[model samples]
Target: MQLVSEFRPKTGDATLDGLLEDAMVRFLSRRPADRQDALEKLWDAFERVKTLEGSNKSVAVPILLGNAALGSDPFRELLTDEFHLLTRVGNNFTIRHHEIGKTPPPSDHARDYLFVRLASVVAVVLRHTGRMA
Candidate 1:
């Protein structure tokens, strides 16, 4: 929880930031059940990347590739049951987008629904973060 609150996206690292965005998009587009199975694997990869401190981006790249190959884990459970990930991503994206203040796409309604779902997850996550973090 606290980890997520503290986890501002690392924009300075353009490559890593792009990878994270791609991973999130992939996860968001997946089916719920498959997302769950895939999320465990994705989380595992993130954990692995955290440890690849000295290996340079090459080490992380494979992990990112593995995550991309695994596909998006739209595991709402991770947001509902877990915490940090959804809230941070949601809150960050919400704030980030608004700050940039771009208009929603042509599919604004659909995008809104997705954003709402993601926000709900973020709310749950924030509560979890308050307790756990």
Candidate 2:
């Protein structure tokens, strides 16, 4: 099992924090075959935070992932590309919006990678928003 010691989000918002914690636990405990669902839940957690902050009204993913608030323009562009790729992977392969018969599920490594990346982004958002000390 991969250890996710750094997958911590201190958003100070009960709902968002709870979701992040639940997703972390699910990712840590679930088997590889069951991890795709966990990844989707993790992405949902991030989305929930974005919605809670009222930052995703016009955007698909969180504005933090694409906005200048994250960093410089080049860095924001990179993060935005990464976020979009992650979203596409979730929608195309994972259980997020894929039909069982139409799309192939992601492998264990892919799921793990997605979880880690999402966790990192969530942590960044928390830190950026002064929710984490």
Candidate 3:
């Protein structure tokens, strides 16, 4: 799974950029735990990236997505679905949290799949929103 040759997202925020960088480095490692940590950092960045313009998540996310979607209703709906689906995955898995009964990725490939999916979404958002070059 080729996530990217270099994962540099110019989100106009240093902390979020650093988090995204760290996640890429950790995700590139061979260890499974590092991959999980990567997911955690990535999801954290994803959550924060939405708030780059405003504080309210509900308001900011839709606006951020609208920026990315660029007046395409179908694409906007797709982005909306992807945002929720990825959020759910992060929440239900052990990658982002370690509460009671969280489930780890089913396998190494599954871990890779999850990482690639979310990372790609993040890249798209940054690109379409003029945050990344």
Q: Using TM-score, give the best candidate's number.
A: 3
C-alpha TM-score for every candidate: 0.25, 0.72, 0.93
What ranges in model 1 sit over 4 Å off?
Answer: 1-8, 30-48, 51-53, 56-133
lDDT of 1 by residue, 66-131 (tens): 333334355433332333453354334432234564433334344444444543333333233231
**Residue 112 of model 1: what lDDT?**
41
Local accuracy by lDDT, each model: 0.38, 0.64, 0.87
1 or 2, greater by lDDT: 2
Between prediction 1 and prediction 3, which has the larger TM-score?
3
Instruction: Order candidates by TM-score, high to low.
Output: 3, 2, 1
lDDT of 2 by residue, 13-88 (tens): 7877776677777777758744665677777776676664565545634454554245577766766676667667
lDDT of 1 at 92: 44
Task: Give the root-mean-square deviation of each candidate in angstroms.
Answer: 14.6, 3.3, 1.4
Models sorted by lDDT, best on top = 3, 2, 1
